[model samples]
Target: MTEHLGTDGKNHLQRLASLRRPLAAIALCCSVAVSLQGCVEMMVGGAVMGSLAATDRRTFGAQTEDKTIVFKGESRVSKLIGEAGHVNVNSFNRKVLLTGEVRDEAMKAAVEREINAIENVASVVNELEIAGVSSFSSRSNDTLITGKVKAAFVDAKDLFANSIKVVTERGNVYLMGLVTQTEGARAAEVTRNVGGVQKVIKVFDYITEDELRQLSTTQDKQTAR
Candidate 1:
């Protein structure tokens, strides 16, 4: 006989199912890479990375700079808070988003200040809550929710999944990317409907339809080469 699942168990299983599609796609990519001949490995690797860079709206230089900002920002925040609070730093196109928790408003402001000082950080969005550190179980749930939202984006064939970045803290979903106004709105609508999403916050840098068309053209040219 099959065992029955409680409401929580059912929800957990559903979340797992939501994540399976993207994970499976990744696995398939890995399998294909492994099956390729060693002679073509470098070519295939370059192609994959090129495809990803094309899909992202930021210039290649900006992408590298964003990585540097996140790494440095995280280190600075850690030194300041140091076991006293939780912090997550995400950088996109030189703009930083700060989430997680801090003990007081003072620390929250301090964290934002430090992030702003990081080289190449154009601006900072301070979403750090003034509360005690979140428990591990809560954080795990947040991770699951983030994955589900990403899967939902991938399932939405209308959107370019790589164009948007999803971040979850507690139950709130934060989306950051460079997208057209219509794309940003549609992404928020899709994310709002996902399970366990209490709220959806859009941090998108909007572009004109003409700008989007230009980006598409540029990406197509890069992909062709």
Candidate 2:
């Protein structure tokens, strides 16, 4: 049976289209994943993330550039830090967030510089701590905290959950999105209350509600045409 893809207004078809080039790679990985549960989990997670990316307000081109920025940034960080630090690189709409811990101020500065050098990186937020690297247990707990915040946002129902990206490091939660001021505040408020979060930081691109409405209308018109 042949599977046919169609647009359903919420970008489902777009996500499937974006997966075309990777279908071959994904097929190859299916065999390997059968032997490794971790590999299967990674593949499923990446696919889910890619599906979400297609629904992002940023242009598909911008989404691709954001992924490129993270990949290039991580490659450079590995060369710079090796076993000296633990850093997580996240790029949302081309704005890169640097989290985790480096050994010293010098290393933190170096990480920022290396990331800024990545093409299409509009800005870099260096939230990396200058202290001993986090333990594996700590990092794992941070990941759980991030998931909790995202799930909370979905349950809130007042905001488009996909509009925000959450990153957690050492219990600090960072939120990134292109949202209205009201939306940003609401998101921050909800995230701050999520269990295990130590702090909340908002890195949002604010626009008036009218502007957001106009953008949505324009997109609908474009899609209709």
Candidate 3:
């Protein structure tokens, strides 16, 4: 009877051990499922964040910036001028470019002083001519010239057309860009050829050929690494 009891005890222990193995397996499976769910949630959250960031990033080119602020600034600039003077306000990315003719140096200084006080202005490029009031014909012709220059930049094969910003006021063409010297010069030449352009002023941040090559090399190395 004792030997029979020992056999029964062994059988019970073996059954308990078998049950523990299945239970352990089930626990492991549950853990894996929870881990996978967490990973999926993290991935979905990242995708949503990435989409939102992309949507928020500003797109360059043909962006008609809100002219209300610019117009208001222009009006304020005009108010600062003498009766004989004119103020031209051209705003891009919050940087205000002031160009036109004022009656005297005082008027010019006052115009700049007034514009400097305006809110949201990043910086001011005061290129106002003090002596001469620009003729209507001259201004009209400058407009035509600007259109032509813009057309040329847009048609260029080697340059990024949208990256070049053309601002013309009173026969002076202001060129803004993040480009190589060669590209900037080419763009300037194109502007010069446009009819009635009195002068071309460069406000470019130039990227040299060697630096551009180095930048390209670095990018390639990063990609390879």
Candidate 4:
């Protein structure tokens, strides 16, 4: 009788362990969904995020460094600007983009100068407008436009959607990517068509078609793995 009870206990534990795996997976999906903030972007970006390390034009090391640069640069810039200036900092492949409004030309120049001094920053594009800080509604609209631009890219079969990072500020759209001239032009053209986009700035690290082909292979290998 004791032996029979031990066998049943083991079976019960095995079943519980089996249940935990699926439960854990569901929990993880929920966590990612919540963290991504937009279910649609998350769904659309799922493929991109999965293959980000593989398919990125920047090498894995460059991608990590770019993220680090953005984190440190944003912290420093936000502190420097205070409430006087509304600044948004974006770092892609070590190049920093400064948008939003500053008090004057001095504040604008200062934002660039400060970010430029950061280590590993290749360059700073200061597109900070001199007008008054934008209202909440304006910024919200910019967010909507950014989502639309990204969704448009996902549907744009001619271009790789994940290759570009889209930023919209005050009706102007800025694109950052490591792509070829053709890809950049294609991306800009797509953005220009998005409603409420006033201007497009291409900040691209142009590569040859051969280089692009080499990068494309990475995704295949990643998938096979």
Candidate 5:
């Protein structure tokens, strides 16, 4: 039997093929980690986190603060919008991105206000749509799409996959990162072609090429320590 796909389906399959190797590598690593002894597993986990932290553009304090912001912001949002909407909070370097759905415009604005009021939140990008909450299946699909985008990023040689934060809301991909203009654009370009990505939104804090060079140098020095 022969099956012919439409243009969109063919493109989607091509994109998925490109991501297979990297995603498989990730799966292999996870499996290996699971087979390790507890002490070895802990050490492996610590080393992985340390490597990510070393390469991260944010300062250690900023990284810590971002995690804090996400936790507190999500908690606050949950309390305020209880049963009114579905919200996901992602904070990178104190800037928060709000994605998902709300009951109405007022709820959307209120969510933003609540997120903005969180301690150490520098700014908020409110991308909440005024609609009924998304279903579990839709959210699961978004998660799968997000994973595919991230795997595609990992497969791209020119981009630092860890540098870009990917968030998906109803098939819309939002990229948050501290990257140079060229890097941000390249990241978006790569993301736009990925399977299941309906749109790519760049929510980036841009730096100069010189600044990027400095960051790379700093990361190398930290990693060599």
Candidate 6:
């Protein structure tokens, strides 16, 4: 499926066109939910929701440069749905990845349809598993791992953790960051060594030396401050 998103341009367009309405519906439902729940609750909801949305964009863009182009197209369509802070969206080429909890099946299907409507989306990966809101302990674990992983990269020579985003869910570590081949190997090794990590899946975009240098500089500043 991912390979298709990378090589096949025509299929991507077909998928995006199919997804628009569903995604718009997701945005609508979220907007309504926030209005009913009030600002305080909405803010709390945004924290996790925002991460899911951002992770999708960051992960897909880092995975493939071609997919990044597809993502931009899909994002523009979603923007029209307005900024509903609850639902999260991710797209790679025409493959749309949806995650995070929603209130009902209608919302789920709506999001899936909207993503399918985009011009270049090859397919929609509807991983928006119906589940309750995230718990405090889960969020804390995510924060701890992100901070620790980013910190580890700072001290490790030639390794940049900022290029990697750490997502800890149910003790499993989902690593989404860009890195050079060597840096990725190092990051994987470090993740395995981390206590409480059930597993680490390396989802990274391998970059050239020049890109690595830029990332390294950015990482240095992050580590310093």
List of clashing residue pairs for candidate 3 = none
User: Candidate 2 vs candidate 5: which has greater lDDT?
Assistant: 5
TM-score of each: 0.81, 0.75, 0.58, 0.76, 0.82, 0.44
> Can you tell me which runs of candidate 4 are displaced by over 4 Å?
1-48, 222-225
69-139: candidate 2 lDDT, tens digit per residue: 88888899999999999889999888999998889999999999999988998999888998888888998
Across 111-223, the per-residue lDDT of candidate 5 in tens digits comes to 89888878898999999998899999999999999998888888888899888899999999999989999999999999898888899999999999999999999889888
Top-lDDT candidate index: 1
Q: How well is each residue in 59-162 modelled by candidate 6, as lDDT tens digits?
A: 34434643653466347535633333234455433344555555567766876776676555656556554666566787688668757766766667666444
Residue pairs that clash (backbone atoms under 3 angstroms), model 2: none
RMSD of 3: 14.9
TM-score of 2: 0.75
Worst 10 residues of 2 by lDDT: 1-10
Model 3, span 85-189: residue lDDT tens: 767787655567778888888887888778777766667888888777778887887778778887887677766665676878877899875578898888888
**Residue 194 miss distance in model 6 (angstroms):** 1.5
lDDT of each: 0.93, 0.86, 0.73, 0.86, 0.90, 0.60
**lDDT at residue 11 of model 3 (Cα atoms):** 89
Whole-model lDDT, candidate 1? 0.93
Clashes, model 4: 0
Which is superior by lDDT, 3 or 4?
A: 4
TM for candidate 6 is: 0.44
**Local accuracy of candidate 1 as per-residue lDDT tens digits, 85-116:** 99999999898999999999999999999998
* Candidate 1 residue pairs that clash: none
Error of 4 at 88 (Å): 0.7
Output the lDDT of residue 219, model 2.
57
